[model samples]
Target: MSTGRLIAAYIFGSVGRGQADALSDLDILAVVENNLGKVAELDVIKLVPLQFASLKPSISWYGAARVAEMFQNGELFAWHLSRETVSLFDPNKFLQTLGTPAPYKECLADVRSFRAILSGIPPQVQQSAVNAAYEAGLVYVCLRNIAMAASWELCEAPDFSRYSVFNLSGLRKCPISVEEFDAAMHCRMASQRGLQPPHTATVSYILGIYSRLDPWLDELEELLLRKENGRQYAQNAV
Candidate 1:
């Protein structure tokens, strides 16, 4: 009840879409007056464990002023929360006071940035399966955002789903397979929730699949970046 420095919090992602399963973890954006240095977060979460056990929440922190800044900057994540979020805690209506965010306009650039991060995965996975969970987690997040950003850029319905990369289609078939996608997703969730890492067999499987991951990043990159019939990419759709 006495949540110090916490301004507001909201639920988003799968739970936001009304499409969560036992496997899905709750995603929370906790808008705080300021970030509690990392060590204090462990102490604060000890405040409410049982209540959040079933949902297995993953909380991302943002300073209240930072949230306002993100809105002003027209960040995709700001728009994402605006569209698909359910307020969990807000005594002062901090988010409501912020009002609508500026339009999202930098999807292609974001996609390119995430793709660059993914480019390192193949070499890392090739070196050792010990980091398979980390490598798979990278692929999962990077590819998911790449798809989401591309959707926003193309004037398509934005999908913030874990499987959005696979969900996106029409221009080219998804390079990620269902099984591969699921494996990577589990790795990410496990890392996010500090749960047990993936099984040895899963690590091996992910490693095998990753050797091919880089080759297709180039493929999907082109598809996402292509201009359709000389049309300009969408801007300010939100």
Candidate 2:
């Protein structure tokens, strides 16, 4: 099996199909037998969970076998093991191969910056856009840190539906449009076997605090994307 496909099978086999979320990253660890000289072929595949028809999965392969070798030796593992990973699947053997831990000061800074942003928004605006997404980000970061401390291979995405188990499901459902709401509710009922009114007002109360106390949330999103992409670019440069 191809490297990427092999990893997907493991994720689906271990975590069950359809468990990954839109924001989840796929962390694949492949071992090449006998230090194969100048090996070339490697692949990765990602699929959006639902309703992301036009988005294509991001794929990357190292042109240099040296890069692949270093990666397998854990040179690039720290980035994945950072405070951003919410692991979906990581094998036992691979877990034993963990490299040295990276200091998460940078990660903590980003998290603190995001929380700081939450404090600068207006009260009314906080009641809407700012609250829900900010709280989601906080939930995501906390989960990411927890996953890292556990030594699991961290995929940089959180499974929101999985995240729902933390009482954030209702919070995730808060941002839906009428159509989105109906669909999400349908899925919720199908999965849970009953209709339950979302904790809209409750989520709002928590998110409201985050929103009003923060800066515009969009700025934080852009900052995180830039930082994450920058980290990937740095890793690729290694």
Candidate 3:
């Protein structure tokens, strides 16, 4: 794909927000002027410098029109773009014109996304250290999303750090010890960095934490569902 077709590009997530740690990966969003269809033809690796290749880029592609629509609809992507992203390339300044989305809408979207992930989790993760670590990280992300949504609803800035989510005041107290959560976060960080796989102890600790957290996850889901239903009812009554 020609670079001329690119409308804008941004770095988001931890790195963009200046909260990245040693293990953070790069998240890049490329908005193209034309609808390139479902299959992305652009090779991101070819665009970055050779030295930065080791930092494994997680690239997301979208059409310019789709991004504009997302901004108009107050969608999660638009929220991130407006509030959390650092624009790297934008000759036309396309992203500068967009406004930050409503925090409540973003919170609801986070709840919905978390619920979808929770619904898809397998009853038993495969018996491999890597698999176990990956599953544990997935659960951690789901819990973090719940905490983030709650924080946003309260008009507080949502922090994506593991420490913030694990210590969220309104969240049910984590049954795992602080050491255990630390181990899980380390395991996740290592996995993301493509380092050595998690050890058996790390895997067991994370799984145990997940097992204990199941009920809390259920409660969180129920609360979100009730809030959504209430919103619908209020809309209808109006």
Candidate 4:
């Protein structure tokens, strides 16, 4: 629990207080009374980006009892309960008390839904939108996809807008190749009309990575759509 407190105390915005529904950046505190009449405090901190869509960070804080109160009183606790890839401090017993594991299949379903939304983005927008618009949207959409995947797998979610992960060296291991991402960036940049392709060779290198990453998602996509079609077919059969 002290690790949770330390995370809440030291990590700028990880612990979110006040909002029953925790947003991107939050500091949360948990306080309980011991048999000895001493108060034990647990803090959980999380860093979430500002925009519901954007990948920017913000700060917030709260105590554990308050978080429990909110969960009892509000719908937002559902979000907290749903998160699987959280960086827990003093995770030992408190997490186990939170109860049975959530079905990861549900989280994967959410990821597949998010991917569908992304796939719906018009190719025309990809071809013509200004660089900033594309980058902004890309940061949101791509990171959400990545986050949902990590959440489903109960793995750490990378902060892609952060240079440490989104940069050339980092994305080499990502599902989307650095080359395709760069090409996408280039195409968006060149959509402005006067610029020449600055990094053609790198784009090909990236595309090669995309070739590897893209197919792996096929099963996820199929699982998602099959479920959807089944639901619809069942409705019609009814």
| Top candidate by lDDT | 1
Candidate with best TM-score: 1
lDDT for each of the candidates? 0.72, 0.35, 0.65, 0.40
For candidate 3, report its TM-score.
Answer: 0.72
Q: Which window of 10 residues has the lowest lDDT sum in candidate 3?
A: 36-45
As for TM-score, the candidate ahead, 2 or 3, is 3
Candidate 2, residues 1-238, lDDT tens digits: the string is 3322222112221123345554333433333333332222332223323343333333232233433344455432334432233333344333334444433334434444544443443343456653443343343343333223222212233322333222322112223233333332333333333333234423554444344323423443345556568888999999
TM-scores, all models, native as reference:
0.77, 0.29, 0.72, 0.36
Specify the poorest-scoring 10-residue window by lDDT in model 4. 162-171
Over 21-115, each residue of candidate 3 has an lDDT whose tens digit, in order, gives 66667788888867554334344445554544566588888888888788887665576677777766778888877555544465666776785
Against the true structure, what is every candidate's RMSD? 4.6, 13.4, 4.4, 12.7
Model 1 scores a C-alpha lDDT of 0.72
Return whichever of 3 and 4 wins on lDDT.
3
- Rank order by TM-score, top first? 1, 3, 4, 2
Ranking by lDDT: 1, 3, 4, 2
Cα deviation in Å at residue 83, candidate 4?
A: 10
Local error of candidate 1 at 149, Å?
1.5
Q: Tens-digit lDDT track for model 4 on 141-225? A: 4534544343333334322222222422212334654545555555444544445544442323433444454554564455445
lDDT of 2 at 217: 33
**lDDT, candidate 2, at 28:** 31
